[model samples]
Target: MPKIIDNLHEKIFECSLKLFGEYGYNEVNMKRIAKELDIAVGTLYNYYPNKQDLFFTVLKKSWQQTFFKLDKVKETNYSSRKKLKYSIKILYDEIENRKGLGKELTKANVIKKESLDGIKDRLDGIIRNLVEELKKEEKIDIDKEIEERLIRVFFLSVIDMLDKYAKEKENNIKFINYIIDCNFK
Candidate 1:
């Protein structure tokens, strides 16, 4: 007979998230995670096959949570500019909260770059939608491709910048607002 632990999966995920954020993916391992959770390493394996799987699961969950928050902001009775600003704020906060997890993931190469790229593309699509809405609202006469490319650049830059300088959230928000207000509105 097998013994079942209540909310073991959630427990594992929460522990992994904290461990990964604090020590990074490279420094943390299955043994350490299991130890922190007061479970046997084998039991942890039952939830996640390996370290990479666990890390990826935690990363995916974090992104989904950020997207969920952004969706709520979208549903609000806010202007397109407000929606885009709040969405960027949500993204910046997530990046700050991740605490070098991206760099660790890149260094470890545990997952293909395409998997991360797909996540970026999804986020880009969301930002692009908001940008397009603002552009249409303001009747801006910019090229679609150029607008998209700029948004991609800005999005990538924000991640890089925020990760490098953790204290720049307010400045990033201001910069984003300035860019959107100047060009889109």
Candidate 2:
């Protein structure tokens, strides 16, 4: 039945997400995904042409989930500084939760560099919008260019620290708090 086929399709996607999360992007293959879903490799290929296509679908799904949470944060009636802090925390928690998977994804050759670049650009746009909103609420006393540059630097620093000190939760919190206090104070 069409309903049974749809259910199977959903199961395949769920299995793929778990496998990718556990084994990393490059380590997971269509055969393994199909096996995990109790389906044949040819069935998997029928839905997705290749492993790269499947992985990209998974990545886009993950991004959509993240953006949904962020949209909620943006809708809250909190101050811009508070919103920024929450946004940073969301990103930090996501990266920390998938630390190994993220590192592996970066190293995977199957994923194109342009794909990562596109993700970066999207994230940058989100951060830039947050910074612009904060500027409206606070007296930053800086030129637009300088403000944008500072926000970019801060964003990069947070990402770097998240990658470098992922295991040190206390230290990471301290660093994030320090950055917020210094910049948003």
Candidate of highest TM-score:
1
TM-score (all chains, Cα) for each model: 0.86, 0.79
RMSD (Cα, Å) of model 1: 2.5
Off by over 4 Å in 1: 1-4, 102-108
Q: Which candidate is the best by lDDT?
A: 1
lDDT of 2 by residue, 45-111 (tens): 9889999878777776776677788788889999988888788778767655654444443463758
Q: Give me the overall lDDT of model 1.
A: 0.78
